[model samples]
Target: MIIPVDQLNPDTLNQVIREFLMRQGEDWGLAEGHLDDAIQQARDALVQGNLVLYWDENEESLTILSKEEVNQSGLG
Candidate 1:
C-alpha cells in the first residue's frame, strides 16, 4: 500500500494533493483560513522533506505521513 517516492510523477502528485485538501475542507466544514493553514502545513512538510505520499491499498487512497513515522511503522 505504501508507494515508493521514486514511483510517482510530481505533477500528478500535486494534483492529487490539491484535491485531497479541497475535499477535506468540504468534509470538515472548515473556513477558508483554516483550510489555508492546513494546505500550508502540507506544503511545509514537503519543503522540510519530512513527508511522503503513499498509496493505501485497503482504503484505495493516498496519504501523507512523516518520514520517521513511516519508517518506524516499517511501511517504508
Candidate 2:
C-alpha cells in the first residue's frame, strides 16, 4: 500500500528515513555532514514525487522507494 509521507509523525518519519539510509550501503559515506545531505536528498525526492513511501503488507514493513522501483515491481 502506498503511504503518504505526511501521514507519519515527525519522529517516526525521521527514524524511518534514518534506518533506510543506514542500510543504503556506502553511497552516502560515513561522515555526519554527508549523511545529512543524503537524507535531505531523499526528503527532496519524496516531496518532488520522485520517491514514495510504501507499506508492504506481506512483510509488514515500510519502505522508501523510487518511482521506477515501484513501477518495475509491478506494484504501481
Best by TM-score: 2
What are the lDDT figures for the candidates, one per model? 0.68, 0.83
Clashes of 1: 0
Residue pairs in collision within model 1: none
Number of the top-ranking candidate, with lDDT as the measure: 2
Per-residue error for 3 in candidate 2, Å, reads 0.3
* Tens digit of per-residue lDDT, candidate 1, span 1-76: 5565456687766666566677666543355557656666666666566777777788888877668978899887
Sequence-dependent TM-score of model 1 = 0.52
Candidate 2 structure quality by residue, lDDT tens digits, 2-67: 898899997898788788888883765635547777877778888888989899999999988889
- In model 2, state the lDDT of residue 1: 86
Tell me each candidate's TM-score. Answer: 0.52, 0.85
